[model samples]
Target: MEKYGVEVQEKKQVKEEGLQELPGTHENIVLRFAPNPSGPLHIGHSRAAVPNAEYVKRHNGKLILRIEDTDPKRVYEDAYEMIPEDLKWLGINPDEIVYQSDRFDIYYDHARQLIEKGAAYMCTCDGAAFKELKDNCKACPCRDNSVEKNLELWDKFDTMDAGEAVLRVKTDINHKNPAIRDWVAMRLVDETHPRLGNKYRIYPMMNFSVSVDDHLMGMTHVLRGKDHLANSEKQKYLYDHMGWDLPEFIHYGRLKMEDIALSTSKALEGIENGTYSGWDDPRLGTLRAVARRGIDPRTIYNLITEIGVKMADSAISWKKIYGLNRNLLEPIANRYFFVEDPQLIEVKNYEGGKVIVERPLHADHMDRGNRLLPFDGSAYLAKSDIADGVFRLMDAVNVDIKGDEITYNSTSFEDARDLKARIIQWVPAEDNVNVTIVMDDASLKTGLGEAALSDLNVGDIVQFERVGFARLDEIKDNELVFYYAHK
Candidate 1:
């Protein structure tokens, strides 16, 4: 799998330094995972969270959970709620949760301070006026307004509804980067914010809000997607102008691809158009979807670990993700027998007898011991295995299949060789065993009562012995209901 871009950058930095750790311990070091509440976090967002939380944890520092809800037009209620929940589910519990919406007053105060310092001014130039000027954006005629007049305009801005006017910080319009040319610090937006409601209109842009919040939150490090590196430089300028302590800024490459869309807007459109189930749809790669599909949090952590944090952008494969998940789950998952598309087999002419088959939970690890399976004369085995001429039952016992008849001589478990043929999973049909096994397609319904199955509960994970890993999807009236293992 291709490594994440951020991982590449980190490697280069480390090679140059010949060390990973900073010189001395910065005991007060603080990091943050600031997710915008415009949409539920996707797999790409999860990638960002892993390293950030790890850095804080390794340093025994604080990880602040901040919500950047400045984009009032795009923010959603459910999206906001999901931000923290997803982080918590991933085993990343931030020390504090802060919302930019709640800090409007603080942002406004800073905007006023900039005005008073002659560093910012109100720009009434409408969108049309900006487009007409194009590359040579003419400085607003009010750019040189007196401090007294600017304060009144700032006060009016503090009280006006959103979208009314914008406060732009003074910067050279001829600067090489267009983004550095007097970007808006605050804008008047009257739209109803999903989280804050109609409380106020003035909202800070990302560059302004992040810089202010990082400072106020006492953050010592700011690690984010490299797409925001330019914005980081802009923010550094603000910190310099204000004479405030500047945090270490590290930008990693963004998680993106050619065919795969990463924009929340595109995701929302897919849901609205009925092209996807919802934000949690497995196909979308959102955190909820990945969780629902049985991808463990540790798998996500390991995935990012292998990729490392760097500046070169890359695309990760779902296969690599599953491989990690399988490794993580191998030790804990209980083994059971499940044969999808089962074919009933009868040992003709033999008296009905029962055999206690002991199958190890993990084939490679004997310390896990074996699980007991009550096998009767009649059992359901995979139809494909029966057609393949031979079937190896657990414990290295081979059952020769000729036409519809399967003949096997009883053999001592100790003397049996490891099953050379595929070990076909079986469920005792004569013992009234009820199992709700899931296949690649539809879920199966066995006649046995659902209560008898062990290690199968809603959300409980299990490996169907020789079949595959699965999660209990539903359990009702003592029946096992499982979903196909995602890993």
Candidate 2:
């Protein structure tokens, strides 16, 4: 059996299996994947996006891609386009695309409704002062203002500068969670929104905007991080105030990927400081980075689905993703030869002159055709594989190496097997392309790849025989650049 065959089989079984039933009414099931457009969608974002999309597909429901870009400071202008492009690459097609910046009026109207119902109030108190009062289980002085007064105060929001005022939802002041006690619903942001510009001074807070949108947009299930569990309690007040039916809130566990940075702000900082490349830098966990490395979107989908919406936290290593990705790439990615840090070896006592080696692109799938390589008596083998030994030169010849001497032996696999020979890959010294592989650590490995690699276009994933799998990233100036995916 092939490596990861059982794991891949298990994944196939998971694909055939359905997720546990959602708790709410099945009729008109709608889900929304609301990601703040701080940066391109990363693997963390996929954890939320994939499940919603898969559930929608299973139930024949609607999935909304909501760009929660209300925070002018955090919004990345490029993310407005990058987010959708990343999602499209992930095969998650939202039924509707909406931006929170476009729905300020709607959020404002909902705020007005809460104010009219005396369930929300505009607090002109300083942030620190309001926090002091709320911490003591006491309402801020502004909290007691009349509904009419609050409405008048809300009307004066345009006149308010940033940080001067915020609309607070009426929650239990004595609630155990101080963070939830009278949470701010909306605040004044004087900064120009990336999408909206200076059109409005007031902006809805994440919880407020998310709650309002989920309710108004008819979101049937709200898939969110477990960290939002308290926010879930906070949003319930708005639902109660507006007499709106609450969406089924599903709080999934925290998915902390080991060693993979998911911070958009930090990634942007790295890019700006020249500490890293762009969003798709090999080290980044962004979907673009993963895609550039030839990681199939289905790998993410399958992995996330297998994790499902469990509340138990999952801390996964890159190996987990690589294992799953390897399963998906094994049967598809073609094979080639890449000799890293090449050591030249003379094929002495070779009766054959110039030989053309035609190896199958994919051993199991012969229909994929062959990769042809013409070998003379000289070949480039990796320096690490040049130790004294009896070795098989892949589809070429068997060789006996002792010290500086390397002499050709019989080519029969049976003969090589009889001696328990090591198998090593090699590229013909003269008939190879200069290749550079960008490793996962953002390090570069320069080598000589089989001339056949030049035929592969950008974005093609290929296994470098004894080397690992890599995706062709660029072909320029007679050199092939690849991003190493995994072993």
Candidate 3:
């Protein structure tokens, strides 16, 4: 499975997934995961963050967790704490944590240096007018502003009103990419920053702050998406003007995940309007959301490692994740019976009195012990599983179902096998615990679980026999709440 010097994951039963080697050789490989404070990390973010952390681990280098909070209007105050928490749950621990919002002075210093070198200037042109000039490959009148005047405006930048002036980096006006034509380095954001408040108004743009910090932090290698190719080019100009060496930039393709909501803004809107429960709502692709559904952090690690750093775009489905997660959960997760939309079946002609059948919690690991299921001539079968045919009540007895009447046929598992009867999951008719499963689509599936489920505590991952895997989220006074993961 090796490709382009990257270690490939073997096809079957590998202990751990492998990652491809980074492009260049280096004594110190410094990488960073810079997430914006606009929202918590989603599934799309892990495509960039996990590889950086894994590469650092493989090279024995430093990994930095930088929170990009330059945009005050987009910043969600709570994400300042939530981002790191999510990373911790994913088993990613950074060597250093940095906040772009905390380094305003650093950015201001670099902005001044760019002006002194005539690499940047203050542009006071109207937005629409500047775009027309830029589109026509013509330099603005402010492009030739004296360094002294630009520095003077820089000193008075904070006092200026929003959109009054902007500091622009000098680039080729005739460049093929219109976006590269003298991009804005600093702007006046009138809104109050979530962290620093109204202490400052002049904030460096994303490229300016990112470029400055990436160099100052001694990053040796940078992992980015192909969409950021233009951004990388834009940043190199900043490095060139500063007389600093550029870090090796590795760009991968866009990762598109189907049937999952990855937009933090939309998720927040949904939460505000009562359309979603919270950030951990099952419908979202947030790490917390996946974690709530019994998805192991190792599963996420394996997924990214297997995908590696390919240059081509990757499209994935939730089924791929469920398949990987099931392998990790199968041997460890204990099994139990849960009957959704239960139908009562009275077992006639049964001679047994208060039959209690003990089944192994896990078939492969009998040493872990067994769960007891008591049947008192009455049991519940899922209504969907009940048809006009013979079926086996799991480890109990074989029965024939003929138009609402269930009669005991035999007790031998062999007889049920010979009759080709379907092995169906069942819960005792009495003392079954009420259960509510929060499906991945955020729909609720209410059902009855075996009485033995009462002994389990929250945060436990278990299989619901014929049903799929689920994480016990909460235990109410009369019911257990679980979030469905996958089949």
lDDT of each: 0.71, 0.89, 0.90
- What's model 1's overall lDDT? 0.71
Error of 3 at 151 (Å): 1.6
Q: Per-residue lDDT for 1-487 in model 2, tens only?
A: 7868987887665334535667787777999999988889999998899889988998899999999988899888999899999999999888999998899999889889899999999998988988898889998888789999999999998797888888999989999889889999999888988778799988899989998889879999999999999999999987888888988999999989888755898899999999888999989989999999989999888888888888999886789889989999998899998988988889899888888989999999999899887877789999889888899998788999998899998788998999889999998878889999999889999989988888888889999886799999998997999999999
TM-scores vs. true structure, each candidate: 0.84, 0.93, 0.94
Best by TM-score: 3
The number of clashing residue pairs in each candidate reads 22, 0, 3
Worst 10 residues of 2 by lDDT: 12-21
lDDT of 1 at 86: 89
List, residue by residue over 1-487, the lDDT tens digit for candidate 1.
Answer: 2578778877776431211342334586788998888888877887678777877777799998888889877787787778888898889999988888889889888988888888888877775675355357557676889888888888777566555578887767676777677778888777888877888877789899899889988888787888887788778778876879888877777665323564778878989999766776545667776676577888877677556567788788766777878887777776666665567787554443677777676677889677766666667776655764545666534666788888764443443334345456676665434556544233353433212355446787777654567776666664566656554
Q: How close is candidate 1 to the true structure, as a TM-score?
A: 0.84
